[model samples]
Target: MAAVPPALGSWGAGQEYDKQPAFQRLLTAADWRPAVKVAVAPTLVLLAAALIAAIPSDYQYEYRFQSAGFGERFGSAVSMALNALGAPFRLGYQSPLGHDRTDRLEIALRVLPMTVTVLWCLALWLGLRAGLRRRKAVVGQLTRGQAAAEALRTALVLAAVSGLLGLLGGTEWNPSGRAAKPDYFGDFGSGAQKSGQPLITAGSGWLEAVAWTAVLAGLLAFLVHGTDALRWAAWRSRAVRGWAVSALAAGQALAVTVGLSSVTAFVLVAATSESGAQTGISLAFLPNLGLNLLGFGSGATFRAHSGLSGSDGSRGDSSWGDRSSETDFSFFDLHDLTGDWRWAGLLALVSAALLGRVAFRRGLDAADRLRLAAVHAGALTLLMTVSGVLMTRTTSSSGWIGSARMEISQEESGGLAFVSVLVANAVWALAGALLVPPLLAAFRGRGAGAPQGAVPYAESPF
Candidate 1:
């Protein structure tokens, strides 16, 4: 008789699972569990941060416009929270007095609160590290493909949640305006007089929501996997290692600069005698203020534009013009605020010293030093450009006043200021990189003699 067929036991099921395609394997719940585990903590943390940040703004809005009910206020908070994550709102106003002469206004604010972003990134890193640690404990080690797939899955989960929240959060604001009033006395010789009330419409679009979600998802993936990719490249190539080291040094210098700026901002906020609500608002914008200070330190100019125009191709009689006015200031000018130019000098000195320490620790030769300088300068210039682009804000309003149409606008600096900022930061970074390390080394060498308990100068880590 032929041997009986083997039963489909656990081992047989395992064999069947192994025979399936990789994509099919990934479709299993167990395969997706790690992604969910990694995503849960960061998603909760991000939503909490967004809500906390939105509170001050929501309070201010409630105080300013007491007409908004709980629903409207909550929706406003949701909108602000979404905006913090890089989504923009489309706001339009239609005047009630218009047949086809509607006055439309649109405002876009592209700035991100760096404080919230930094916190969210920290949470994400922690979650990813925890998830990886758990996976390694169970599976020994993950291959490059496995690690990449994990990161992609986590990002997709995050994006899906964000998109769903956007959809459910009530993006559009209710149209609000004053009712038309009848002229009882007929003193004005007109019929019912319509107030200059506008039917305001404000909400972010699905396209914008999707676009920002995609961007955020990509960023999450990069944050999760970029270090591993860099490490792999560094291990394979000496040039890559050098570039990575230089980039790290550049990042350290930037951290020092931003830290100094943030400290200054905190001090200023503390000293101000503003109301609690105003102070809360200021606290919410603290990161933006820090970046603006960074821009000021780098010799960047802030431009202001306020203009008024009529609908009939005529300029309004107001003094405001279409031309923008640039306010060029230096780091030293902050002495008026900080009470000393030495504070600015201190920021520079600390950053330079940090870079110097990095160079000395690596035992970089002259050529390596030059490469570090170039990399640092390039990194700083790139950061300045990014900050300028991200921090821009624009607003415009138009309305009719007795047949004389009026329009007004306010905006920040234009593109030329970004170029100027990049150049300034590059120059400063180059000087710091080229000059600081040798100076620090010389200073340290003055007391280079080894004490009885001390290691020899040649063997010293410094």
Candidate 2:
């Protein structure tokens, strides 16, 4: 009797996952079951928003005209909930935030939806982690393609969830041709009073849904696994510290600057408005208002118009009240009316600089880091710009006596000043990656590659 050789299965313990075909390695069923986890955060956010929406119940009449029966009331609430769910599916810049029939929702759908999108990525990452644990792989080393392939499964699931939501909400079809129909894709803005609208307008939300899917999948691979992008990269331990610092610094700064400023403004508005109830009603619009602050920070701008009372000052036209007044606050200036927003702008600049420095110092050469920074900043800026463009909806009505004759209708974007913001961010990110590290390094009297911060990992408390 002697010791016997271990079974092949036991020998395969740590590396079994790697032996599988690429497709099987990635698109397996492991990640599918927990895909539903993606919805949890978003649902929670919507529920909280609903609670806020229902707090007083005094303004409940805004959504419901009479509400005699329970079923109708329930249906309307369900509709509103679905609207909350679907609202962020637009350009990802604007949230449903609530509205006063004409007013937008008070919540920023951007943060919640982005959280859900990250959760979607997390679902896949968790699956990979579980599988790696089985394989005894600690750092989860693998090709970028493998991680991307695994991510595709989760992305598909996310898309399916989005499609399901769209189907459930946008399926407003009418067989009776007697009434005015809202635009097929009109769930966000107005109701259709007519009939014969398309049976489905589900694609409206899918664009953003798909966009999130792509972003999440890529991030899951790059941030968690380091994927193929790690080929020329240094060891994770050596590099993770730098990467984590950059991310944490930027994130914390953004949270502090953007979050604090937005909340402060909201509180001030609530405190000062003439009526508390009226103020609460306007609270639904705070999401958009906060977004205004964000635009100031990021140097992006959108437009809004209001009714004018007096005649045109320049021409002194008799029908001066015929046109709505327009203004531009797209970028932050020293003399901005709101000082808080200007601070947000400064914070954003600092964050961008930190991002460039950290990302460049992580592992890659200056050129590669430059490319990475450009790609990261450029992609995000592009998304925001495009989303802003899509979100610029214009509505016009006659002046006092039914005349929009002051000027012709123009395709307006509410001032989504993406073009300028895009240029500004790209220049900042590019220059930061290319210039900041060297400048700082020279100041410290060390070469660029010298371990600079050696800070704790982003997820680490130490």
Candidate 3:
């Protein structure tokens, strides 16, 4: 039997997901279910955050049993648990430890959410980059109006994701004392509350508002620029160059700040505040695990293509023989497999695939389409990984911090929760510093190929 030529616009046919539509892409490529698998990490993170928010403002999950002297026994147990699970995501830049209970918990709880939020933001940036490229392709395939419509859809999704994450970080689930209990004294008493306004307002509210604004702007820009690239060749060309430079620069800065904030905040809070056990998942674990798998798979595929490796052995019995022995391999690099940097590699891969597919459509034997699939898949893997990690961080931290804040707001903990909340905020702020650079670097690859467009495959049902 003659080999089925790889499809260009849809998920690569003649490959594992050849039957799937391009638009149905999700967290895990292998899993087609819509529940949580497709949305994967980010969705999980969001759910986790929601759960954290759902915790009653006055509810406290306390584990206190001072059997061995003062706070020793109780503190040791909590701290131990935190240390163990916290290993994978530990950005670990702490000063000498301290005995401050509020301070320690604050640091531990804050790091995860801040790191997770920053990481998700990075994913949004990458999605924007991909959406930009995809829109450019549509402009070429359809009428200018149609291309614009498709581009708008892409931009909206990316923007929405970014907006949601920002909202997660900026908003506080547990309201404070004055706000939580407005009717201090009810029947037969004057309802003169000391503080009339909510504890969390203005600046915090403004921060979230601005975050939403930026998200919207980013989404709109990506749609306009991407479709524009296809509509007007001259405009598209300039837009591509500008988008590449701007996206890369922004990603680099954002990742760095996020990373640094996470690290520094953790360290400072761990040192000065009461230390709880390092608890919950880090922002680097699951997503990176996925990336590692992607990198290894891509590496194997590359070797196969280069003839440095052999076939799966079962191919020998196929009617087509081994003409596609090389087709089984991929061409993405390992270092370019994770972080924000993977976007650059994705663009390069798409370019090659687009050219190859066009050539193949016009009757040219080529491996470009396979390479492009490998790259795009790799980028998606990278995006999902980062998003997942960030989401995990957000969920884990939000629960801990919110619970703590509840305690403080109730005055049983003497404003300790408020302090912890601040620490968490600090950690989130610094995340952009530490994590963005390495991420941005992952996307930096040669970008000299012609732009590629993605289209739906004929065989896919969804």
Candidate 4:
């Protein structure tokens, strides 16, 4: 019998030329659309989240919880919906079925968006796995340049869709209209109050609507395309490329985690300031905590590069030669600026490989995982840094003025504290966003840079 070629056929019984029904096919448009749909739901949920976020601090609303009794914060919408099936209806009071009605609704509302975010994270993981599997099947046999190009293409598409949607969703640009301005930021509300005019006008409503639409679209695009990029990475490397990609992925995950945590910190500080308490616990912190958990969980892969050991709890050493190993750096140690800068060097190493510059003579397979992680880490780190700087400046500049209660009756003139910082940070973030794509692309190369033998999958894993 003739030996079967792995590259020529599927592991299961199938022919490359065979035609199959839509439902039965793995890589069909119909199949992929579900992922897109799943991806889109979170964007819509986030859009809702942004809207809830935008409600003036003055807006009167009921509080909701995720569980019965009290204290539980965000809950999964799916869980809430199921709970609601048997929940009794109540008016004005809280319902115990989904935790109390108001709290439950709030929890449900928060959870709805979380469900999508979690899914997005999951999808990215699955996509990367698929890329690896595909690449492995064709180890030592591919056009390196073709593979790199494909990865870049996928990343670009994902970025474009995300950006467009973000613009459409309320998030593209924070509303700057007079009514949308916070009382702490300016005297718009107070002036309106003194002038005997409405604080919110119809024109502001139009702007808000436009903003929300852009943000929702951007959210959808971000999740879907980001996952797609990961998937693309899996097959862009054969044995040599795989290891490089993995390393990059690990580094990127680490950086993004840090960046996101910083954002949460600022949000916390702001919320705390508003409550008149310097050191109270916050419900908002949960999301950031969850994000950190997820990042570490995913990044563990790079720390333990031997098989799936990272997930199993065995971390490797932190030395550069032990590139694939994981380490448990003390939290206090990480806080040191010098220590952080040193790790930034490690990040640079991981990123360099993914951009197609091999380190330590590592082959494509060895480099694949790490390099991809690095790319993610690099982009995320950049975003986090940009956002962090802005948040710090904005909060500080606003200072106590941001916290002072400004009713329609008070004299105008607040928000002088950190206006300059906010402006500086915003400029930094915009510059970072603009620079990341080109920088990422530059590493992937113009043509023939993927490393020989990389294979590609026809469909996304998630």
Pairwise lDDT winner, candidates 2 and 3: 2
Segments in model 3 whose C-alpha atoms lie over 4 Å from true places: 1-44, 52-116, 122-148, 154-247, 277-462
Model 4 RMSD in Å is 21.0
Which is better, 2 or 3, measured by TM-score? 2
Any idea what lDDT model 3 has? Answer: 0.31
CA error at residue 249 for candidate 2, angstroms: 10
Stretches of candidate 2 exceeding 4 Å from the true structure: 1-56, 60-64, 67-149, 169-326, 330-345, 356-365, 386-415, 442-445, 448-462
TM-score-better candidate, 1 vs 4: 1
Could you list the CA RMSD of all candidates, in the order they appear?
7.6, 12.3, 25.3, 21.0
What tens-digit string does per-residue lDDT give for candidate 3 at 206-316? 233234434443444444444444434433354443334333333343334233334533443455555343222333233332222333222322122211111221344
Candidate 4 lDDT over residue span 168-234, tens digit each: 3221111122332453536544453333321110111222223433443344333333444444455
Clashes of each: 0, 23, 44, 75
lDDT tens digits by residue: candidate 1, 243-357 = 7777776677677767677777666677774766656556655656665565665565644333332223245455444554555556545646766543544554555566666
Off by over 4 Å in 1: 1-28, 53-65, 92-104, 170-200, 205-223, 226-229, 305-325, 331-342, 386-416, 446-462
Residues 1-462 of candidate 2 have per-residue lDDT tens digits of 999654332224545555656655444435543334443444444344434544443333334133223322232232344332334422111112122112111112222222222333445566655554543354445566655654565456555554554444322222222322245435533343221222211123445544554565445534544433453243345455345444444443344433454465477578778877766654554444444454456666555544433333235444434446666665554474766545666545664666555654564455455555655455545434433322222222223433322322222234346676677667766666667777767777877764343444454221
How well does candidate 1 score on lDDT at residue 211?
62
lDDT of the candidates, in the order given: 0.56, 0.45, 0.31, 0.32
